[model samples]
Target chain A: MLPLPVLEKAQTELVNYADSGMSVMELSHRSGLFTDIITGAEQLLRDLMNIPDNYKVLFVQGGASQQFAMVPLNLLSNSKKADYVNTGSWSKKAIKEAKKYGEVRVIASSEDKNFSYIPEVTSSMIDPEADYVHITTNNTIEGTAFQNIPDTGGVPLVADMSSNILSEEIDVSKFGLIYAGAQKNIGPAGLTVVIIREDLIGHAPESCPTMLDYKTHSESGSLYNTPPTYGIYMAKLVFEWLKELGGLKEMEKINRKKAELLYGFLGQSAMFQSPVQEDSRSIMNIPFVSPSAELDAAFVKEAKEAGLETLKGHRSVGGMRASIYNAMPVEGVEALVEFMKHFEEKHAQ
Target chain B: MLPLPVLEKAQTELVNYADSGMSVMELSHRSGLFTDIITGAEQLLRDLMNIPDNYKVLFVQGGASQQFAMVPLNLLSNSKKADYVNTGSWSKKAIKEAKKYGEVRVIASSEDKNFSYIPEVTSSMIDPEADYVHITTNNTIEGTAFQNIPDTGGVPLVADMSSNILSEEIDVSKFGLIYAGAQKNIGPAGLTVVIIREDLIGHAPESCPTMLDYKTHSESGSLYNTPPTYGIYMAKLVFEWLKELGGLKEMEKINRKKAELLYGFLGQSAMFQSPVQEDSRSIMNIPFVSPSAELDAAFVKEAKEAGLETLKGHRSVGGMRASIYNAMPVEGVEALVEFMKHFEEKHAQ
Candidate 1:
């Protein structure tokens, strides 16, 4: 979900952006007006994230799912082997895609426990000769997140941070590459933000599709064939909103408060419980299970009627999941907890 | 430019789409609301285009540039060779990308004439063993378009119709796959629409990235992952606006009138002239030039001051371009023509 202010700003500017008498969607990608918008967006993002000078921030399309293949295609030039941590469904998909390009070793995995936690990773687990180490920093479906960034010795680390990118502060130097879909903690879908170190920018094999090469985007500053113009504009507004709200550090406090309120209720409630482990819980997506499937269905239905939509869990994991991203106000969590309490009282036997 | 009505409707619904208390950007990809939006969009397009039942409409990302590679990757399974017509800059890029995947044979090209006209393509020019024959139906940069669809015998035809997909009526059955980036006559920059024959699907080799394979999107109905939700919604609105205006036939008439008004002025004006040959001129993008580069710059500046934006020609071609797409009303074209006449009079040599 986007910050409300960002959505409203987009609404106001949808038809005539900045008196140009054209929607952001209608502006030519090479026009000076759009140039300002894109450059301004990059500056805002760099300021918000405190991105390092060595990192090239690229705004491209196809989401993190596309990055699953791109990360391997562009980075697997050295050993053609990568170490991957299989935390959940997304990580498995990433690993499967990576296997197409090179040898993908599952250095660590939480699959044995239904992917309920982030697998521990150490320098010893990684292959020193590997091209890079891959991990999903947050699993939206499994409701698990890496509590700490793993050290991969001198090996470059690549992360799919789609679900929890801007929810917290992080050191930009921690990873060699970071990619995230703009749907969560950024803006809308269709735009993918890739923050890659300069050294990792041009390693793709010649056969790599020009659209998939980081060097193509880095050289063009992400203007390589109309880089999701409206999405970037929306992201710029989102970054502005985050900055106005005192940036990620302050946003993280509000997010943690919201997660704690919901998880605190779940910990005490007799009818509902979080499916994820305590230490591995994701502040972005919190999946919970009731006592029975019927109860879960009824709770999801009643919650929708109570104005809380999309509370249903993924089909693979039964029960409900609450994705309280950065945009979810603390009151939203409070409302969900209140509904849960009332339902527990009504269903008591 | 998008239809003004469509942009207005999007602005009105940007924050609370259909009273769902969430922006279309915030909707879950798996939600019923988004499913309706996407399905409704496809149906509207089918109804408007009269697309055959055998053709699947896939709303994918990465634009036409991405499809340059995907076309060969997915279709080159049979002969590992394809035919291409180099009409302009875009076609050259397409050929270059396709060369990475297979043997790309350029059977026809207008490059000998500086891509100022579309070259004729006959069935005899096509290699029957080719997996697919590629063409750019309308060249945006060079102001050229095929007046007639080429007969490629049994070889499948793939088109990059990014600049002119919705501007006029066409026979969808003639092409094996038609892909267009949405920024032109559709809605925005992020979403790409691919209409492919069922026989052409699932041909990508296993090494192809899951996101790049047509089978993945075709099988999942373009919901394999989070799509550009808001862009799809905007495109749906555009389709509805087109349907309201009597579909493609009416849109074609209005577009023709706009193009005629601009081109007619250029024909009569002594100072300005269209570079494209008349028979191969595009109704979508019409590039024109004044007597000198100084006059061209002056005209572009004056046009901008007169509230005409993005009239400057592409860098590869100097002077001016007046793109009169489906969304450009006749009044806009009339205004451009009026400004052109005034500039010509003032700068008479």
Candidate 2:
């Protein structure tokens, strides 16, 4: 969700950012304005996440899916074997890409439970020789999240936080790298935010393509080539807005309230059931299924009519999924909960 | 240059694009609306370029620079050798990347003339056994353009049209593949348009990164992952505007007029000189140096004060440059020509 304030700011400055007569789109990325934009976004994100000075934030393209490939390209070359925790479809996709580059071990998987829970990770499952242990912080389709980041011992932990980043407080030092596609919780699509420890870069074998090399982007400070200027500018605005809203601690407080509002309603609903296991349920994505497919269809249609849109679950796991990102206002979720109650009463068993 | 009409359309539809109640930025790339957007953009670009049925237009990210690496990673792995024609800085960059993947033969070069001219190419200059031949359709920094497409004699020819696509009419059927970063003639940065022949979609070497594989993008319709949604949407609008104003034939006519306006003035100027050879001069990027470096700096300063922006020439070759892309209006060139005349008269030694 692009917050209303973010939209207003972008709208007011669509033609020109700050005092520059050119739109952010027209500014040469080498220009000082753009340098400030990309750097400001990084600094804001760093402050918000409490990222360590050792980490470098690189703005890139090709989305999270590309990172699924890039992570392997840059990191896996150092240790061909990397431990992967398969929680959902995103995990499977990442593993498939990594296998092409090096050895990827599925150390633990919740696929047996239809990915409705996060699998328990133990030190035995982690290969000390492995370069990194990969995890999807939140599963958007299956409505699951890592309630606690697994202890990787000394192994570098990497995560795809595309679905839940910026919605809660996280220890930046806990993970060696964290990448998120910017469509959710951040700004727009097309921009991928990669926060990597400086030590992990430059290990890719000579066969790795230059663009996929983290070293290229890191050395140039994410300005190796022309970046998605407009997206980065929007992200900077979103970060500014996030900072103004009292950082992630405050963001988490509101997010938990909003998530609990809908989840609490689901807990009492007679006609709806959330598929996620209680301990691993995602606060960011709440997926529920009605007693009948016909009822679920009707509820989705009615919810759209009531201005609650994009409630349809991912096709891979069909039902209803409400993504309540940081930008989703409490009023929106409360309204959704109210609507769900009305629908439940009308179709109660 | 983002045309005022494009900006106006984007501004008016910034928050709710076509009554969807969501900004294009927030739209799910997999949603029907976004499908229409990405596909509509491809279709419009296909229409504009008269792309043949045998060709596929893939809207991938990472810009033309990424393509510089991707083209070699995917295509050159077959023969492990490719012929590259060096026209300017962009060509040199592409060759540098291609070398990392496989052997690149400099078939012909104009560096002897300080990249001020496009070298003539004959079929003999191409390595027929080479996987492909590479060229830059237009050099953005050095202000040189290939007035004629080289005859590769059945060798697949890949061209980077980042600075000149849509500004002119060309035979799309002639090249094996063409890619452009969207910042110039398309819409914005970060969106790379890759139009390739169906036959060249697959067959990357085993070591190729998944994201760098053209097949990954082509097979998924450039939707295998979240794409640069907003950039594609804006490109759609720009395409619509272009179609409304009579497509590429008309775009070419106006662009030629704009080019001639400035070039004609440069031709008559005594103190101002274009370093490019006449036959190889770029209609898109017009670079001219004054009699002295101080004079060139003064002109750029005065031009910016007069509302003309980003006229500084690339530092590799210091002077002043006016990038009059397809979005640049004839009046923009007229004003620049007028300013140059006034500056020349004032600084005449």
Candidate 3:
């Protein structure tokens, strides 16, 4: 979900952007107006995240799912071997895609516990000769996240931070590359944001598809071939909203409060419980289960009727999941908790 | 440019789509509302284009540039070779990308004439064993278009129709696949519309990225991953606008009238001349030139001051280009022609 103000601002400028007499979607990608949008977007993002000068920010399409393939296609040039942490479904998909290009070793995994927690990673677990180490910083389906960034010695660390990027402050120097789909904390669904160190830009093999090469995008400044113009405009508005809300540090405090409000209720409730471990819980997606499948179904149905939409869990996991991303107000969590309390009282036996 | 009516409708629904209390960008892809959106969009397109049952419409991402590699990666399984016709810049890029995956033969080319016209493609020029024959049906940079769809003798014709897909009526059965970037005649830049015959699906090798494979998207109904939900919704609005305005046949007539207004002026004007041959000219993009570069610069600047934007020609082929897409009204073309006449009179030799 986007910040309400961002959506409203976009609505105001939807038809005639910046008095250009054309919708953002209609502007030519090479036009000066669009160039300013993309350039301002990148600058705003860098300011919000405190990105380093050594990192190149690329706005591309195909989401994080495409990045699953691209991360390997562009980075497996050294040893052609990588270590991956299998935290949940997204990690497994990334690992599978990476295996197509090189040897992928699962250095650590939480699958033995139904992906309820993030597996610990240390420098010792990583292959020194490996091209890079991959991890999913937050698993949207499994409701787990790495509580701490792992150290990989000198190896480049690649992360898929699709669900939880910009939720809190982080050191830009912690990883060699970071990619996130814009659907979550960024803006919309079509655009993917990639931040990669300059050294990692040109490693793709010569046979790599030009579109899949990081160097191609980096060289062209992400304008290689019409890089999702409208989505970038939306993202710029979102970044403006973030800056107005006092950047990630302030956003993180509010997010933590929202997560605590819901999790505090779940901890005390008899009818509902969080499926994830305490320390590994994701601030973005919080999955919970009731006493029975029927109860779960009733909870999801009633939640929708109460104006809380998309409360259903992924089919792979049985119960209900609450995806309270950065855009979810604290009152939204309070409302869900209040609804749960009333339901618990009514369903008491 | 998108139709003004469509942009207005999108602005009205930008924040609370269908009273769902969420922007279309915020809606879950799996939600019933979004399902209706994607389904309605595909149906409307099918109705407007008269697409056959055997053709599957897949809304994927990464634009036509990604399709440059995907076409060969998926279709080169049989003969490890494909035939391409060089029309202009886009054709050259597509050929370069395809050559990375297989042997790409340029059987017909208008490059000898500076890509000012479409070359004739006969069945004899095609390698019968070629997996498919590729062509850029509309060249945006050079302002050329194939007046006739070349028959490939049952060898499956593929087209990159990015600049002119929805502007006219065409027989879908003649092409094995048709891919267009949505920014031109469709809704936005992020979404790519791929109309492929069923027989051409499932041909990608196992090593191909899941996101790049046609069968992956076709089988999942383009829901294998989160789509560009907002773009799809906008396209649905565009389709609705087209249907309300009588479909492609009516659109084609209006488009022809707009092209005539501008081209007829170019034909009669002594100061300005169209670079393209009359029969091979595109109704979508029209490139014209003045007697000198100084005059061209003056005309573009004067046109912009008169509220005509993006009329400057592409850098590779300089002068002036007025891209009158499906959304350009007859009045807009008339205004452009009127401005041209005034400029020509003031600069009379």
Give interface RMSD, every candidate, in order: 0.8, 1.1, 0.8
lDDT of 2 by residue, B245-312 (tens): 89999999999999899888889889888999999989999999888888888998999898888899
Steric overlap count per candidate: 0, 0, 0
Query: How much lDDT does each candidate structure score?
Result: 0.92, 0.90, 0.93
lDDT of 2 by residue, A236-267 (tens): 99999999999999999999999999888889
Scored against the native two-chain complex, candidate 1 gets a DockQ of: 0.89
lDDT per residue as tens, model 3, A137-173: 9999999999899999899999999999999888879
Please compute DockQ, using alpha carbons, for every candidate against the native two-chain complex: 0.89, 0.78, 0.87
- Per-residue alpha-carbon lDDT of candidate 3 for residues B295-315, written as tens digits (9 for 90 to 100): 999999999999988889999
How many clashing residue pairs, candidate 1? 0
- Decide which is better by lDDT, 2 or 3: 3
True contacts preserved, each candidate? 0.92, 0.74, 0.84
* Sort order, DockQ high to low: 1, 3, 2
lDDT of 1 at B188: 91
Worst-scoring 10-residue span by lDDT in model 1 chain A: A19-28
lDDT of 1 by residue, B179-204 (tens): 99998888898999999999999889
Candidate 2 docking band: medium
C-alpha lDDT (0 to 100) for residue B136 of candidate 1: 96
* Candidate rank order under TM-score: 3, 1, 2
C-alpha lDDT of residue A108 in model 1:
96
